[model samples]
Target: MGSQSIESGPIPACELMPASILISWHPPTTADVTVETVPPEVVEGENVLLLINSLPKNIVALAWYKGVHNMSHVLALYSLKYDISVTGLAHSGRETMYRNGSLLIQNFTRKDNGFYTLRTINSRGEYVSKTTTHVQVYTTLWMCEHPSISGKLTVESVPPSVAEGASVMLLVHHLPPNLLGFSWYRGVFLSEVREVSRYTMPLNLSMRAPAHSGRETLYSNGSLLLQNVTWKDIGFYTLQTLTTDLKNEVLHVQLEVETSFSTCCNSLTSAPVMIERVPRNVAVGGSILLLVHNAPDLQTFSWYKSMEKIDKFKIAEYSRAMNSMTWGPEQTRRQKVYTNGSMLLQDVTEKDAGFYTLQTLSRDLKIEVTRVQLHVYKPVRNPFIQATSNIVAVQSSVVITCFSQDTGISVHWFFNNQTLQLTKSMKLSPTKCRLTIDPVRREDAGDYQCEASNPISSKKSMPLSLIVLAF
Candidate 1:
């Protein structure tokens, strides 16, 4: 082969190294945005501003959400740059956005209650800052347009019928939050209204009515305590709340104050006052003394057996003016009336297990000196226990029953001289008259007894020995 002409296609061009290019990027700075509210609380039908402070410069976008999570549930969105737009379902005619990215809400309602979150984007289009605020809306109780949905606000006394000279508490329930102020009123009826007390929470001020005389004290939760109540306090009480939302919520309560001579008659020195008796318990054939203290001289006394308000059993009636004691047609000689206000019974039977009312009037019988309720009771007797089996094998179930001849007796169980408590493995009847144990074990072997008790007396049954066989 001829010497080939060395024609390398073109001198192999030297491949020059491409110049290395370096680029620098800066991490975005977090926008420490602070959120604040004008009143700190949002009320219905009120204007509120959610202020945004310390926002980063050159903000590209800002958005708000109803809840804490901003990724979902977007409430409002704004774009400052290209599209320059506002979009959100809550964007009613009343909502307005300020130049500084603050949100203004107007005519809010209960539906606006929740945590509101804010999200901001930096100029570089990076998700940068976030803040949250809680908003609450309250509605007035007088706006009963939706009674079933919004529970009615009410003020009620623990005991609707309270004795005079006693302390009574007025409890307010179902009250709305975000209250501007609250007031109390007392009147004979709904039409007549008189202020009793007023409290302004925001200002930390409290005012009492002219007639209050410091007897009415208000609690932080809007409850009122009336001290040393008298018959004059008996009336309908109303609770009024002046909410920031510009609505008034009112709750009403009716109080009945009774003049109890025993408890309220401190000024009656000459009246034959009645006293409370320690509950009396007498055997079937035993006698009991029902006596009154501080009875005036020579005041006639009357005794009545009150099983029910209607059809009372009149035991006896005595008149000092007549100087004679008369007995009811059904009253027997077993009862005797004394000069003082006291009744003596020779024998008490189950039929006598009821409240006895003592009625004493002034000498002219124009005014009742005192009225009291005397309770008499018969003791429970003949309590016995019956076991399904005195001896039982392991993993077997055992049942024990308690019985008493007296009705309305509660039965209590004891094991190894210790009171027995109901557990998952043990069950008791509704009346606690029966006890059942499942999966008997050797550890369960012990002496068991039962006791029957009533308000009057208690009786225990003999101890029954239980034997458990191990498998």
Candidate 2:
């Protein structure tokens, strides 16, 4: 045996190549042939290459068998002497053999999976070596329906309503034994449908689509699991199942996700109650709502301006049973309590930026209290940037100040329409309202703007051009 190099031709762009394997041949004694699948496992409709390694010298012919090393199941045969190749009985027109004794299977299907044997023949026309390997074929993405089944396939959620950050499973009911595959979709409409995942029963494999959030799991039983669900997940989900008989079944299930709250116990009663906060940041002269959720069956609920004694700071009160409302000493026409326990505050001012408490008294005399924090900020006015000099030489110092009429507002500087990046030579004042560059470089020359913002609103000034001389 001499040193021989076997190179493969250009593979199709769609084919996925497996890890490279090194092959070396020494003095020819006994043929030590080994066959391996480039990728032992492949998805249906993909190409798979069977690599033959450690070829012995004087190899006259190479033949491939589909299973059990039977001649009837031969896939392809290659004769090195005549430089000819031919397909065998088991050939499904998808198998191709390279001159180097390797085999390529195009559009591999489930029927092509299982044991494949490669047999090497010597110049004497005797089978020198036979190597076998196993290949796994997974199903591809597909959906079909024949509607031959009698009953309807339904999907049910483990819990009808799920809390935020909790996991839920959409279980399939009355699943047929002849199920071929199932797919989960996000929306009800076909035009706007977004596939979550698809599972094939024969392959016992699941494939995720572009809409997968990395929090979903598909089970073989045609169930889908979603973890750490959020408000955005509170919508309708559709499941479509395909059976072996070409029967199709579809079901839709709705999931509701709600925000959770801490439970508080009252000294007067042992019953625990939940309190929810609806924090709001309203601008001056704007209306705001201080909302409450999961309020107990109450006789009356009071909204107070502060957490002080309810009698002194009470803003308004509403009785659920009587369906009537009463104004407190601090309550004005602008402040009103709704029958649902939410309080609406109109024309809010800076003085309203404080904590407000909600005290509820149940019909059984149980008390539950919750607090909400309100922020009343003045709408930020447009800010302008003032520089010591619009034109400066490189390495010169420059001072730029951002000014806004609104107090308690944050100022941000932008360079060329982007957030300014502070260099080592740049410094900001304690309030960050002023920027000073001790040694401005040529790159610093650009348009600059200042933005002033409060919690409620923000405004940006027109661009100010700065020219820096390079020389």
Candidate 3:
């Protein structure tokens, strides 16, 4: 093997030569010239060293060529008198030479595979020596056989909502073992999905101006923790992961950042007023009523979406004189107002998730009555549990694994209708995918259940009864 070349331009000779003509070619008739045998194989992207076995001590010049027939096929040339080395344009970045009658080629690509010839001339010009060697370079096995991706990828944000200047953590789950690296992007909502900032995993310490630069830490488990998060950090974040199997997956998470100081009617409300309870969880195409409470004397009521600041935008309103409901231009299509100061939202969607405020007048003063938080999620699926051995002898080991089609979820195990507690005999994997019981006993016998849950919903698996035999 030889040193890798660092030059890049005009392609190398091996790349230009057709595979059909890379065969052995006779060298010029010179009885004194000796050529060394070619190596068996050279992996692509490795260095190659071509040696001109024996030559006179005082060498006037040395030339390394890709083809034996022409000077135009020269790969590198050296001038001993001037002590200068000029590499071929095609091999500029990756080729170098030794003081001795040898040539060093770095990162030998398949395009570098073929016959290489070296020529040396003594200062006296009395004798000239030339050697020809055949070089074979093969592509790396992994590159030749690109694997397909066969796993899932997900990202979870711990404490999805936070006040400005608070810390937040984003956790990644279900990353494949063959993963190469992952990248994170803070989405900028322009006309499209523009990225305001980005962060790459495996932490490039030298990178400047990265989104998470200086303020974020990446854990070995692929989690990112942001310290002192600000309103600038609010928006959708995307995580893109690539694996060695040539597979890739992208996940998105929305982050809501609130102000540290409140400007709304928090101080004005002397007592905790219960209006109507807002249903936070709703399925697609479902109906939800933002119930109004304790406002029997109000002449009129108005609903608004609380903006980031203290200001609000009216979405719907009710008039007591007309005994009718009126919606804003944008809300009339999806939202219906009731005479009781309540709002009915139909065909709920993920877009409906946010904070809403209801406002009304009390003694000529605008008073903010209640705030509602809404979330729309897809219906949860039913998951099931599987055990390696349902019936086992005392003192035997058993493994229980939970299975779910969902990507991001939390697994909870239960024994005899009670939440199972971790003990000396119980161990769970980091992702909670599997539970292991090292030694089973009579106490281990029960109705085992596994529940998989996420922020959206929870699904319980059918109980699998376990039996234990006496020792």
What shift in Å separates residue 394 of candidate 3 from its native position after superposition? 2.1
- lDDT for each residue of candidate 1 in 1-471, tens digit (9 for 90 to 100): 011111221211111101110011223355356566654434478888888756777666676767864344545555554323344554445556654668888887777766777766655445566666666554442111123432556676766568878989998766668788888787422232367788888988887775565788987678899988886575557788877888987666656576544444445564345443333445667777776655665457667775222234777778887888877644767887787777777676767655566667655554443333333456867565656556566887777766555654567899989998666778886557767889776778898888878666898888878878675
TM-score of structure candidate 3: 0.42
CA lDDT, candidate 2, residue 81: 59
Candidate 3: which stretches are off by over 4 Å? 1-150, 163-166, 174-183, 189-214, 220-222, 230-232, 240-251, 258-280, 288-345, 349-378, 381-386, 401-409, 429-433, 454-463
Question: Over all chains combined, what TM-score does candidate 1 have?
Answer: 0.41
Candidate 2: segments with Cα more than 4 A from true spot: 1-279, 320-323
Query: Worst lDDT window (10 residues) for model 1?
Result: 13-22
What's the lDDT for candidate 2?
0.69
Is 1 or 2 the stronger prediction by TM-score? 2
TM-score of each: 0.41, 0.42, 0.42
List per-candidate RMSD values in Å: 26.2, 27.1, 21.7
Instruction: Give candidate 1 regions above 4 Å deviation.
Output: 1-272, 275-279, 306-313, 364-366, 369-379, 421-424
